[model samples]
Target: MNNELIEKGYRRYVGNKIDVYFNTNICQHSGNCVRGNHAIFNLSRKPWIVPDNATLEEVKRVIDTCPSGALQYQEK
Candidate 1:
């Protein structure tokens, strides 16, 4: 696997924020992250992901569902 991409996928959120960075390459496109939680994951957009759009708890839940480890988060 590419470490650079992995690092890029790992994001940090500030003060109880949700920070999600989905790596397209690593993603299986299972849609679990996008479909499981519409409030946070929206596949229709250009970026297709805005971690800050959802709460930290919600984002963490979705990220955990990612089978490919494509989504990652950190708290600051």
Candidate 2:
């Protein structure tokens, strides 16, 4: 687990090959995340972020688009 991200108020979403972190406090709701991959970041779903729902590259690519730095990830 990323202690720094957790300390910064980002919730962790663990996956088999990757981990996603989201800080709602810092999120600007740019829609980049949901738009990038609904299967991975669908708000209608419980525990919205499912890293394994998308490919690792896709996950990283989308996370990079977070303008607010609300999204972060670590490759397992």
Candidate 3:
């Protein structure tokens, strides 16, 4: 687990090759994540950020679009 991210209030979503982190308090509701990949960022899902649902490149691409810096990732 990413203790640094956790300390910053970012929740971790574990995956095989990469791990996603989300800080809801920092989110700007930009919708980029969901629009970029529904399978990975489905809001209706309980644990919405499923890093394993998409490729590392795809996840990184979408997260890069986050204007608020609320989304981040770390490769394993």
Candidate 4:
């Protein structure tokens, strides 16, 4: 029983990998995720990154655009 697998289960079918945790306290609302696809990441919404909204591959592409490591992805 891997905790990482459990967390990823919460958002299964969304992405190939998952972003475990992110500290937004020092994060600046860069809007990198939303800029490309509002359907995926919306600052106005809760749990900002909506894996269910878009395919995992799409999410990965946007995540790479993040200037800050504030966004991360790990395989389950």
Candidate 5:
């Protein structure tokens, strides 16, 4: 886990190959994330961002669409 991100108010979502980080304060609500991959970014889900729901490449691809810099990731 990244203490720095946590300290910055970014929640961590652990995965086998990568860990996802999300800061809601910085989210632009562009809907790009959910549109890019519903499986990984489902709003109706409890933990909306599930990195393991998709492949590493897919996760990266979807997160890259976050124009607000709200979604981030660190590969394990």
Candidate 6:
């Protein structure tokens, strides 16, 4: 988990290869994260962001579409 992101109100979702971070307040609700990869960003899931569900490249690719900068990833 990222101390800076958490301190900034971003929640952490732990994964095997990477960790996903999200700040709901910063999200624009653009649906880019979910649309990019449902397996990783399913809203129905207990944890909306599942980094291990997809490849690191895939996760990064989708996060790039987040105009709000709400979603972030860090390498393990």
Q: Which candidate, 1 or 3, has the higher TM-score?
A: 3
Candidate models: Cα lDDT each: 0.67, 0.95, 0.94, 0.61, 0.93, 0.92
- Residues 1-76 of candidate 5: C-alpha lDDT, one tens digit per residue: 8888899899999999999999999999999999999999999998998899999999999899899888889999
Give me the candidate number with maximum TM-score: 2
Model 1, C-alpha of 22: deviation from truth (Å): 1.7
C-alpha TM-scores of all predictions: 0.70, 0.97, 0.96, 0.63, 0.95, 0.95
Please give the lDDT score at residue 66 for candidate 5: 92
In terms of TM-score, how similar is model 3 to the real structure?
Answer: 0.96
CA lDDT of 48 in candidate 1? 64
Shift in Å, residue 58, candidate 4: 0.4
Backbone clash tally (model 1): 0
lDDT of 1 at 2: 33
Identify the candidate with maximal lDDT.
2
Model 4 whole-model lDDT (C-alpha atoms): 0.61
Clashing residue pairs, backbone N/CA/C < 3 A, model 5: none
Q: In candidate 4, residue 66 scores what lDDT?
A: 76
Model 4 weakest 10-residue run by lDDT: 8-17
Candidate 2's C-alpha runs over 4 A off are: none
Least well predicted 10-residue stretch by lDDT in candidate 5:
1-10
Q: Candidate 3: deviation at residue 21, Å? A: 0.4
lDDT of 2 by residue, 1-76 (tens): 9999999999999999999999999999999999999989999998999999989999999999999999999988
- Candidate ranking under lDDT, highest first, comes to 2, 3, 5, 6, 1, 4
